[model samples]
Target: GAERQVRLPLGCHHPLVPLHLHEERPSYVVCGGAVFTALSQPYLQHEWGKAWERRAPVSLVAKALNGSKAQRGEQVVLLSQLLGHECVRGYDSALLANSMVRALNGVPILCLAQLAQLVLACRQRSLRFDLEESRVLVLDTAQARGAEAEILQQHNIPEPVLINERDAALLR
Candidate 1:
């Protein structure tokens, strides 16, 4: 008798990644036992859809309103990453699409649970964290103690340095 093998589907990097690379290597995807390349990015829009797809934005708003400070910070990080912006302010400024801002009422906290869900999805599907390749800002000390710090260390991403409180105040 022959043994049957099970293969899992892994997610791919953002569609734009190929344009920036020197070589056109496929995005990193890890199947159960083996890894493979996807011919093209899979479900790019789904990354955005996780928050506003089938559900009501009001629910997200309630979640953020009731969530903790850490949750708010996480939401800001995820939104900034998604928009390819280093900071939440930048995302707000550059994002001309009013729908997203309107959906969350421009409250960054409302994006928390969606961000968490997206992160989990990426892990389960073995998707590459392309958003993280961009510059990241570590504002408060809390970020230094969480997974964000671990990711920065793992990627060798340098944290932005503030020489003094004055400089730190400018970031705020």
Candidate 2:
């Protein structure tokens, strides 16, 4: 992906951030549920689908950035700009742990662009998209079957133009 400048809105009061996948052990949370080293693409989609069904508000969901308090703080600022919401909240410890904690508490954590993709899916039934990393998408039995290909085709996403071996395997 091409790097681009990001600007926070006038009242957002946070640093600009890039929309990139973050990987770091420090940011890793000890989520109290079934923890897999990696989650599949379909799993992630189903999780997002569920969130949409449950009406999880994107405004309050803290983004997963490079594992740091400051970067995490920047998420709200970025979100305020993206979602056009004013009066943003600062990062909460609980929200910071949301992705993992949700898994522990039996809700799938939609990581990376999964949440955004799911939101897009609700409005547009067909579109193409890319996922930079594998995220654990929690779903029930019915929702789990054949979700990845269907979602990818709906979004017109092709095989990645650039990917490392690890990520390639995860996507497959």
Candidate 3:
């Protein structure tokens, strides 16, 4: 009989697995008073403790149980944390955490790298972030740019943004 071969879909093992995980390249981005990162099982576990599946938000648990990549090189980018700043005033509610980012500047966000690019290259007067559950976050572009350095310093974040080269290339 002739040799038989089968190919399985990539990232089929786990729905919450991050698209990119590397030491040199960070999987997170900090900009405009928000921390963006890809959703992963470890993050869920860390945030929700040992009983993450049960303790975590129902929306997240549902994604973990049944979510799949709709397109190649896709990642579940999320607003992991919100920093206090005038640029992001009135959005300090804790409910914003772990909310999946739907789009930035009306462009769909596929990965963390893409989100970073959208933020850094935006020339509009404001940066709009569309999130899950009909939540919308808008920040003044000039204020955000000007406040980023101060926000980083206050939080002691070394870099404003860090993204994997491979992930960045995928968007291009």
Candidate 4:
């Protein structure tokens, strides 16, 4: 018999892949009532509990099982949650939770850091989030900007945006 090697597709489920963590660097960004962050195994586990594979969103689970990094530093950024605010009136948070963010203001989103930068630097009248499944979330730029502080204050959040210096610098 001859010895043979087999390779399995591990994607983000690979043990060697580092999980994004807030302790290492700011893993989330709060902008215009939306909380954005990269997808991680821990997040899925936390959201769905011990039986995450059975309870988690099928799409997310598929990503975890089948997704692979396409480029260096690539991440699957998602709109993890939403905060109630006038800026986001009438939008159902449940429908948007855990939705993968594909783009913002027509610019593709690569990572949480880049998404943060885009939201902050947009000079347009509106900010548009192109999410998975052809879903769109539009917000008035001026209203979102003005309400950001109030949203944070109301929600008792200390910071509106937080990203590791290295990640931020890479974008610049």
Candidate 5:
């Protein structure tokens, strides 16, 4: 991946941001249940989502990025910019475990593909996905059997990505 500049529109409130190459975690969430810590950051995030949002669903995620046309669905994918857990702002909270606490009940990650969809959506709406870190994404593994990044402002948690260490080992 190459380095580039991106500008944020709504929640970020930033003009532009610099993105680095290979700076993101490689973890992912799995399609079935259970979390595997040995995986990379992107993989972990993907796997967790799949387990949590399979068939019968729960809540959703919505992204109002500058250039994205917001997606409307009970089951939508999260964007890369909106990936990291939110930061706590209380005076004491900042110094304490507030950051962790705020994330105690939030989606904390996504993938490159999810970020792409977000970028497309923003581009469609004339917004920017300026250098977002810790992004979230939705994977339609059931249909495509592959990961696809989607930045839905009004979407539920995405189905977790499948983690098959045996197959991954083969690929490596």
Candidate 6:
């Protein structure tokens, strides 16, 4: 399968990346099997993945919200490689959109779950999140997974980081 990716206007300086040097050569994805199979892998510390511990799913969701419209060539490489311990991975479109929206506005991210609901609500009720190079986001469209859908249906919900059980359960 061709994994879809939207490159943000950051982190294009992969010196040894062959495809970058020779555009004639097609780029191949470094497959991350079982997404969390090697979550303990080593990585250099940087600002890239600071949210894994600090904001987690919420931060990621916000990123996705902001990433929807990034240009074709620009992309943000995952800052840290010690990756894949949660449902919200670097390529998760829904989570990235959520995070991107939050980061762009400098707003307090109260809840990932509720935000996910809001993400869907915006689509249903005509709210829009700003993002680019859209990832295959399911938070709004995957209604077969009833849990998130129900959350969207609720009223007077509080803000909180989320791990949509229905969505998470499907990934597991």
Once fitted onto the true fold, the runs of candidate 4 whose alpha carbons sit more than 4 angstroms away are 1-26, 165-172
Which ten-residue region of model 3 has the weakest summed lDDT? 11-20
Sort by TM-score, top down from the best: 3, 4, 2, 6, 1, 5
Q: What is the lDDT of residue 88 in candidate 2?
A: 16
Q: List, residue by residue over 1-172, the lDDT tens digit for candidate 1.
A: 9999989999633221111223333232111111112111122223235443244234333333343333212222222222222322343323222122111111232232333233334322222222222422222223222344444454444532112232122233
lDDT of each: 0.27, 0.27, 0.81, 0.81, 0.25, 0.27
Query: lDDT at 2 for candidate 5?
Result: 100
The residue pairs found clashing in candidate 1 are: none
Q: 20-126 in candidate 5: lDDT tens per residue?
A: 11453432332211111122223323535544234211222112112232221111122212222221111131122101111111322133233223332332212
Quality of model 3 by C-alpha lDDT? 0.81
Could you tell me every candidate's TM-score relative to the true structure?
Answer: 0.17, 0.21, 0.84, 0.83, 0.16, 0.20
The stretch of ten residues in a row with the least summed lDDT in candidate 5 is 96-105
How many residue pairs clash in each candidate at the backbone level? 0, 5, 0, 0, 46, 34
Better of 4 and 5 by lDDT: 4
lDDT of 3 by residue, 1-172 (tens): 8998989777445444553355445478887788998776767887898798899888887777678777777878889989887777789549888899999999999888889888989999998999999998888888888988899999998889877675576577
Displacement of the residue 88 alpha carbon in candidate 6, Å: 10
Sort every candidate by lDDT, greatest first. 3, 4, 6, 1, 2, 5
Model 6 Cα lDDT, one tens digit per residue, 35-111: 11001101111223634335444333344334332433222222122123222244543344222322112222222
lDDT of 1: 0.27
Provide the lDDT at 67 for model 5: 23
Ten residues in sequence with the least summed lDDT for candidate 2 = 77-86
